[model samples]
Target: MSELKEQLKSQIIEQLNLEDLTPADIKNDSPLFGDEGLGLDSIDALEFIVLLDSFYGIKIEDPAAAREIFHSVDSMADFIESKK
Candidate 1:
């Protein structure tokens, strides 16, 4: 689980092109899509959807659903683990 979180953080930083952040900078439970956290926007959300499909082979077709499931690193890990 810890390894998965670390991997997810690395992937998120890379896929989202977050040049300012390292994996250690992102808390597991931190909100990932708002001004308060990483300040990611809709495009980043889409990129995350792509990341899920490409990296985890989890297909998420709905943006609204993706928003809820990919709310944070912990939530994303939970969703991926559930799928697995």
Candidate 2:
């Protein structure tokens, strides 16, 4: 789980073109998309859906659930483990 979370941080940085941030810069418990967090918007949410499918081989059919699953790095990792 820890390794997956670390890899996810890297993926997020690369996928989102967040060149300025290192994996260490993103906290696992931090909100992923909001003004107080990474400040990602709706388009970034779409990117996250792609990220999950491409990297985890998991398809998210529910948009509302995606909101909860993608809420934070910790949540994403937990979701992946649950699916597995």
Candidate 3:
């Protein structure tokens, strides 16, 4: 799970073009969006969907669930493990 979280941080930075942030800068429990977090917008949400499919071979069919699944690196990791 820790490895997945670390990998997610790196992938999110590269996928979202967050050049200012390093993997260490993103906390596993930190929110991935909104004003208090990474501040990612709607379009970034689309990129996140793509990132999941391309990197992890995971597909999110339900948009509503994405809100919970993509909440943080920890949640993403948990979701991935659940699928396995």
Candidate 4:
């Protein structure tokens, strides 16, 4: 689980081109979107969807559903775990 979290963190930073953030900077339960969190927008959300499919082989077609599941790193991990 820790390995997955670390890999996800690194992937997120790399995929999103967040040059300023290290994996240690992100909390496991931190919100990934909105002003209260990473400030990610709709584009980031789309990227996350792509990330899911590309990295995890999880295909999420509905934008609304994706929004709910991809709300935070923890949530995304949970979703991925459920899928597995």
Candidate 5:
């Protein structure tokens, strides 16, 4: 699971062109969006959907649930595991 989270962090940074951040800079439970976290906006959320589909072969069928699933690396990892 830790490995998955690390991969997620890397993929997210790359997908979003977040050149300023490192995987180490993002905590497993840290929020991935909003001013309280990485300050990511709606566009980043769409990239996340793409990332999941491209890397994990997982599709987010519900846009509404994305807020909960993409909330953090931990949540994303859990969601990936669940889909598997």
Candidate 6:
């Protein structure tokens, strides 16, 4: 699970082109949206959907579900593992 979390962090930075942030800079439980954590916006959310599909082959069918699933790296990793 930890390994998956690390992979998620890397994926996030890579897929989102977050060149300013390193994998270690992002907390596993940190919010991925808003000004609270990564300061990500809705555009990043759309990219996240692409990231899920491209990397894990997991397509998020419902846009609403992305709000909860992409809330944090931990949650995203859990979602990926469950889909597997």
Model 1 alpha-carbon miss at residue 67, Å: 1.0
Q: Regarding lDDT, does 1 or 5 come out ahead? A: 1
TM-score of 3: 0.92
Instruction: List, residue by residue over 1-84, the lDDT tens digit for candidate 4.
Output: 778888898999989999899999888888888897788989998889888899999998887778878787788888899999
Write candidate 6's Cα lDDT for 18-78 as tens digits: 8888899999998989999999888899999999999999888777668999999999988
Q: Residue 20: error of model 2 in Å?
A: 1.1
The TM-scores, one per candidate, come to 0.95, 0.94, 0.92, 0.93, 0.93, 0.94
Candidate 6 structure, TM-score to reference = 0.94
Q: Tell me how far the alpha carbon of residue 48 in candidate 4 is from the true structure, in angstroms, after superposition.
A: 0.2
Q: Go through the candidates in order and give each one's C-alpha lDDT.
A: 0.91, 0.92, 0.86, 0.88, 0.88, 0.91
Quick one: best lDDT, which candidate? Answer: 2
After best superposition, candidate 5 residue 25: deviation in angstroms? 0.5
How many pairs collide in each candidate, listed in order?
Answer: 0, 0, 0, 0, 0, 0
Error of 2 at 41 (Å): 1.4
Rank order by lDDT, top first? 2, 6, 1, 5, 4, 3
Angstrom error of the Cα, residue 15, model 1: value is: 0.4
Candidate 3 lDDT by residue in tens digits, 2-60: 98889988999999998889999888888888986788767788888999999989898
Whichever of 3 and 5 has more lDDT, that candidate is: 5
- Give the distance in Å from residue 70's predicted Cα in candidate 2 to where it truly belongs: 0.7
Which ten contiguous residues of candidate 5 have the minimum total lDDT? 56-65
Residues 1-84 of candidate 2 have per-residue lDDT tens digits of 899999999999999999999999999999998896899887898889999999989997876568988899999999999999
Model 4, which residues run further than 4 Å from truth? none
Better of 1 and 3 by lDDT: 1
Predict model 1's lDDT versus the native. 0.91
- Whichever of 1 and 5 has more TM-score, that candidate is 1
